[model samples]
Target: MMENVVIRTVSRLAVPFIQIFALYVIVHGASGAGGGFQGGVVFAASFILMIIAFGTANVRRRIDNRGIMWLSVIGITIYAGIGFLALLMAGNFLEYAAIEAVLGIPHLHGILIDLVEAGIGIAVMAAMVSIIYDISGNGEESS
Candidate 1:
């Protein structure tokens, strides 16, 4: 963990902005450049930043292994649920348009696409954080 006050303060302040930017990247991906995978890496970057500034144990208090696994599960469920829903509606998996067709809701296609991206972002972020935590070792403060 970083002991420098300046670095710790700066990182603390920057984490929120980093997360917002990641969300922007994910949302904007629906229309133009950037997407789930990219945004996910960005989101995970914030947690990585936290680990650098605050250390694993500190971050873990906020989000532990169980929480990470739950996040992964929720994200995967969102993605797969949408795909299966489409399939049940007589369309190929992940066919966002089929949902719109069946529900007759205009503009649902874009929404569904965005949802899938959100799920991807969540899952990716969780996975990345999990890996980093594991690789960072047992969070013991080395003298």
Candidate 2:
């Protein structure tokens, strides 16, 4: 638990940039070489960096166990909800075209894809962080 000023300051400065880049990857998923998995892994890497620099205890204090569970649930729900919405619209699962027609949006398909990517990112990030926390004995469920 030794605190080094230089290390701490550098980590503090770098974390925000890491997060921003992760978001950039998620948003630019449609344009080029980026998507939910890459962005999510990058986001999780930021937390991993925090765990290394600060400690698992600090990371857990920031996000907590219940928060992770809710994040996972919300993410998958958003994903499935979109699929179900398509079904309700009388289309097969994940048929974004149906969503576009029903909602009458010109570019709704791409936007919905982006939304799904975001959900996947959130879920992956939570899962990765939870896995790290558990492996390091920081998870609440750990005895």
Candidate 3:
């Protein structure tokens, strides 16, 4: 845990901006230079900052092991669900054209891409955080 008041304060202040930028990267991935992996790493970095400043015990209270596992599962489920839905629609796996036909909207492909990206970002973020906890040797309660 961080002991320096100035460091802690600065990390607290910077975390929000870091998160916002990560979101921007995730969202902008559909249109420009950014993607799920980059955004997810950035997002996880914010929590990592918190871990460094506040310690695992404090952060774990806010987000436990179960919570992290669920988030990762949910994210991958979303991604796979979309693909399966497309397949059920008689299209090849992950074929956005199938979704576009059903939705009948402009740029449906882009929308689907964005959704998948979001899912990937969520999964990666949770997984990375979980890894950090494990490496820190504080993921489990000392019973």
Candidate 4:
């Protein structure tokens, strides 16, 4: 999927909208039955599309490897941070009740979980897309 996006420049135009929609899905996962993992994959698809349309060099110009790496790290850190916070408050990792108390929204456990999952998804997707872009040699030669 990433490869196809990178090779097709047309996808670039649609990437932004796709990413936004993915975020919406992630945020509303609790109500709509979607989650972070799904949204993250969708978000990553945007970068893959950019890479497909533009090539590594072009993509790199837009977003350097270092930046992508940092983003990946930050994403994972956010996931872990949330889990750690939950553990501190609830005595269990990723326990949303603890988070709810902290945030003063004790009734939105599902929504909170969805937000966390979305963070995870974004991170995973970005990392995966970066990896794919790094490995893919270049856009396929035009016929």
Best by TM-score: 1
| Pairs that clash in candidate 2 | none
* Model 2 misplaced stretches (Cα beyond 4 Å): 138-143
Q: For model 2, how does the per-residue alpha-carbon lDDT over 7-111 read when each residue is reduced to its tens digit?
A: 778888999999999999998998899998899999999998888889888888889888998999998998899999999998899999998899898999999
Ordered by lDDT, highest first, the candidates read 1, 3, 2, 4
Model 3 stretches with alpha carbons more than 4 Å out:
138-143
Candidate 3 lDDT by residue in tens digits, 38-101: 9999999999999988888888899888899999999999899999989988899999999889
Clashing residue pairs, backbone N/CA/C < 3 A, model 1: none
Which has the higher TM-score value, candidate number 3 or candidate number 4? 3
Across 29-65, the per-residue lDDT of candidate 4 in tens digits comes to: 7777777788888887777777667656777777676
Give the TM-score ranking, best first.
Answer: 1, 2, 3, 4
How well does candidate 4 match the true structure in TM-score terms?
Answer: 0.76
The global Cα lDDT (0 to 1) of model 1 is 0.90
lDDT of 3 at 79: 92
User: Each model's TM-score, in the order given?
Assistant: 0.94, 0.93, 0.92, 0.76
Between candidates 2 and 4, which one is better according to TM-score?
Answer: 2
lDDT, each prediction = 0.90, 0.89, 0.90, 0.74
Clashing pairs for predicted structure model 3, backbone only:
none
Residue 12 accuracy (lDDT) in model 1:
85
